[model samples]
Target chain A: MTATVIDGRMVARGVREETARRAAALTTAPVLATVLVGDDPASGVYVANKRRSAAAAGIGDVHRHLPGTASEAEVAAVLDELAADDRVTGILLQLPLPGHLDPARLVERIPPEKDVDGLTTRSQGLLARGEPGLRPCTPAGVIALLDAAGIGLAGRRAVVVGRSTLVGRPMAQLLLGRDATVTIAHSRTRDLPALTRSADVLVAAAGVPGIITGAHVAPGATVVDVGIHRTSDGLVGDVDRAGVAPVAGAITPVPGGVGPMTIAMLLANTVAAAQTREAAR
Target chain B: MTATVIDGRMVARGVREETARRAAALTTAPVLATVLVGDDPASGVYVANKRRSAAAAGIGDVHRHLPGTASEAEVAAVLDELAADDRVTGILLQLPLPGHLDPARLVERIPPEKDVDGLTTRSQGLLARGEPGLRPCTPAGVIALLDAAGIGLAGRRAVVVGRSTLVGRPMAQLLLGRDATVTIAHSRTRDLPALTRSADVLVAAAGVPGIITGAHVAPGATVVDVGIHRTSDGLVGDVDRAGVAPVAGAITPVPGGVGPMTIAMLLANTVAAAQTREAAR
Candidate 1:
């Protein structure tokens, strides 16, 4: 039997529409300050899409672009300005900052309340403590995707492949928060397929192309592929879709799946940040 | 084959001796300020033992005991004093604060630098981000125990039975940080034995007595039991020792296992805090 393809674009639109409604209800316009350091083509595309999504959601976008030669202190100064700006409700620092700049230090400059990207130590700490705070977008989107599909996470044996701070680690924490028995397997994991075969829910975020084959999945288990690799044939995911689709119960496609959800969650987070600031006021 | 009993007391002694050597090299004595909000018999005993351990490690012990009727503000005040005191290298606010007080708020009052207990959100966040910072004691102790035993965590299947922020959550993160395939299983986990049996290194921190038996263990898998329940029959661990011993390669006994390691880690953290402060000075 073929697997049911989870429609991420449709889910993302729903999220964007919901976020727009929330933005309309706010007393003041929600402003998101987007900091883009350097002219990396990929980073530029990501920023442009984020800005477009913010506009669609009725959120104000404040773009701050710096040259490839911008110093760490200069980037930090821009973050400090946005963080202290009363008009700014959220801040997003487009990542992969020039090799000279330390992303962690710059991310920390975004005050926790306004940290829409949720890459700061404080935000991660809040997630770790299970406290209320902005969550990292990709993992948050993954959870939202699962919820939208009506997949029950509680008590499910969910296995996550990859342990990157941006996705894998937080993804495991989110699943565990929902009472799923979450396991994280990285490149160093022994007998990877053996472990994946035991998972009722499998998430692949190893950033490797077509790492998961049909042999890696348990029969009738849900698979969420968080990896997207650009190949001569275009975008490919971690899962070997052709091979695994017939065996798995459900799966998310590469470009349209986790990618759309990430943008949608960013919009949601921005609107949520505005509401939080408003409530505090 | 009978399992090798992990001698936690012996390991703890080694840790303390190493900590004492470090403390002796310090320019000034490292002071650990223990703040006991109420006269909880158990808390008092724990605090007393911690003080005794600190003394043995050549660290200074400063005890602050408040009445059980203390308000949240009063507890905060005590923590505030310890945080600002230049003499206090580390601050430990004993757990199970009076029912009236919110432990989270009081725990947050301890400065991150002096937060020896590592219960604050900042410390937990630093851990999540894999930034170098103080870690929660119990899980840190568990890692120390594993290291002292020459147990290789990398690429191993490590299952942690419990998801507490204090133990299970951090324990999973530590193992994941070390490149172990880490899984967090809680009360909601289905087919617990099936999961535990897959673990090369099984950690039981469920706080339930004798929750893991021989049937739950994979033959030759190392078991670390973190639960200790005092019954009329005497102290019992999460693992049914008599039943699991023959099947396991290595096992840690109840009282002599995690308990000593925890105290030893605390001393290590205290000395480390002092060193950090000294370096900054």
Candidate 2:
């Protein structure tokens, strides 16, 4: 049986439209400032995508670039400037900065209120406590995709096959917040199939290409693939689509699945951040 | 065959001895200040126990008592005073303040460095990130108990049977940090026994008395019971000792298990907080 494909691009569009509506309704247009360090081609492409989307959503966009050799203090100064700028509603720092720079130190500097990516310690703390705050875009987008597909999470056994701070960890917290009994499996997890086969909702975010296949899935289970690795065969996700698609009841395609939702969620978060500041004022 | 009883009291004593040594070594005597709002008899007993333990550990102790009708500002003022007081190395506010008070707001007032209880947002964030920071006492104590027992957590299947901010959530995070494949089951979880029975290490913190029994445990699996309930038949934990002991490899008994360890970990965290402050100076 062929599995029903979950269309993430379509779902992300609805989200972007709503974000645009929100941005249009605001008294002052929201501004999303992207801080890019170094000239990594991939980082440049990602920041440009985010900036273009923000502008399309009726939000102002600003880009701050730094040389590869920029010192920690210099990057910190830019963050301080953005934080003090009332016009800048959200801050998005392009990651994988030059190896010499400490990522955690810079992440901590993004004021929680303007942390659109929700990577700050304060944002994570709020998520841990089940408090209302901006959530990490990728996991938050995965939830949006699940909801859009009408997946019932309450009382379901959901297994997240990764534990990275960026995606897997926060994804489990998000599932738990939605009342799914969540399990987090990683490289160290023994008998991965046995643990994942018990899941009603399986999320593949292990970052390893094609780590999940037909044997690892439970029949009729919903699979959300969060991995995208550039392989010889173009791009593949954590799940092997060719092997598992027939066995699964529903699945998200790698390239168009979680990818589009991420940028859409970023737009939503930026607008929400601006609305919060406006309300506070 | 009977399971070995994990002696929490013995382990806790060892920790307190170390804490005392550290406290004695400090240039200025470390001080722990506890704010008790309202005269909750149970809270009073708990505070007194902590004070007695602190004094025994060579740490200075201070207590601030406020009437049940204390306003939010009044409680905030007390916390602010303690936060500004250089001599007070750590601060703990007794839980379950009068019904009129907002606990979160009060808990937020405790400075992260001085938050000996480790209930603050910053502490939880640090725990989530697997960074160095004070952890919630009960979960930290659980890890201490596991370590004392020489339980090998790496690559093991660990199931946490709750998701409370105070215990279950942090417990899962700590176990994950130890390289255990962690699954969090809660009240909404289905097929609870099937999930719990799969665990090589099962932690019962569901706060439901006798919720976990022999059927929920895998043979020879280590069980840590974190629930304490007052009943006519004496104190009972989430695990039915009579039912689970015969089937388990080792277990922590209710009164002598987690209870003593909580106070011990609190002392450890207070000393650690003091050491951090002293190091900065």
Candidate 3:
């Protein structure tokens, strides 16, 4: 009675390889400039993985190292430098800076064209307007995985759990654009279990592990887990891996689910950045 | 125990009169350039009403009347003309244009500064970013009504019963900015009543009449009805007026509740637009 497991690692590899091929075809080698701030171990791990993935994806000009503990002005300066650099097609600033920094204000300084992370207000505006542009990688990955699964979106009842600006909001927006009747359910939502029971597709992005259990899921629904948490026990997502998998039609696993896809999409976004040189011109 | 009724017509008159005073004070009256395309009777009535309201607010330089059969290029041309107009502080393209026309696209053509209706992507972005800027009238009016009523939003549960860009989405964003634990419910939402019943403040913006009934409302919760539908009996709202009023602590009447607030906010936005000029100087 177990549901199909969504193999995100393999899917992400395919996506990265595809991006590599496309990137190699481009006249100029795509580059990603990542500006890191403060010594957050998680941010360090993420940035390292991204640089490695970029190189593996044939984005050969990737800048692998940036100083940790860099001030807001310094980080913005690095972004400005990269923005002007011909080699760098995309710029991503590792987030949750020191106490004194205004992260959103610094983010606004990144030119929209180089905003691969899609956290910029302008990029969000573009997404809300349903225009083609660089999208938030996590949400973009969710859609890519769903599209890869060949799931029909029309008239489907999709309940997205979480409403953060980064992932949940944009995911609901993308789902809406694909014509799935989408509703965003957040932490404050009452009877969350009851709501999940009615969903044809459930997207768990709340960052709360084991929030959606077996009893909560509708029978035969595709579930995409966008949450990745590391506990003393192990890697887990917002959805209970064992509990909901049996009832769900297909489900994405935790460590392998959205994590790898995040890097792959970042590479894809770089290729997209380079392609804009032609598509927009 | 009947809930206190919030009067909107009276509030709207206050807003309109304030606008009139400012308009009268201006050496050269501010103009509201209204562009309408394709003769939809409802749209015609709406635009004419806006013109009368503009005049009543002492805003004399109202450039009313636009072609119904205007081409996209022609409409854009009008928008461009308005954008260049020094006297026009507010430019609004009346909604639901002809089949071939894109209302969203036309809304973009209005200069962001002159986008008095606050439907442009830029304005929406400003709202999303929690920046100082113009806002959508209906949603802005709802917030203003709460403020006017001396309602405190801190640590409150705000339920916005809709998800459209113009009202529901922005309303939720506004409430989030105000520290309300916000939830957005819609047609696809399961057990919508259970969700609404927990709200300290309930906003009905779904445009469906008699949707939020007595059973759906929380006892002593402030109810702000955003829906205004013409029923066979008369004007109606998403909240079941008669049924929910007695159970609610504060209720906004249909004709007098959100309607006047909309016009008042529109006038308020115009004043804000004028103030921006001085700030720029």
Show pairs that collide, candidate 1. Answer: none
lDDT of 1 by residue, B68-91 (tens): 998898888988988889999999
Q: Evaluate every candidate with DockQ and list the scores.
A: 0.91, 0.88, 0.23
- The lDDT of model 1 is 0.92
lDDT string for model 2 (B136-247, tens) is: 9999999999999999999999999999999999999999999999999999999999999999999999999999999999899999999999999989999999999999
**Clash pairs, model 3 backbone:** A38-A69, B8-B256, B20-B57, B38-B68
**Higher-scoring candidate on lDDT, 2 or 3:** 2
Which residues of candidate 2, in runs, are more than 4 Å off? Answer: none
lDDT tens readout by residue for model 3, B1-281? 99988878877777777777776776566777777777789988888888778777766455546667677888888889889978788887888888888888878888888888888877776766567778889988888788878788866778888878888888877886676756667776667787788788999988888899999999999999988889798888888989998899999988789987876787777767876764676
Predicted complex 2: CAPRI docking category? high
Cα lDDT computed for each candidate against the true fold = 0.92, 0.94, 0.81
Candidate 1 residue-wise lDDT at B153: 94
Q: What share of the true interface contacts does each candidate keep?
A: 0.95, 0.81, 0.17
Error of 2 at A56 (Å): 0.7
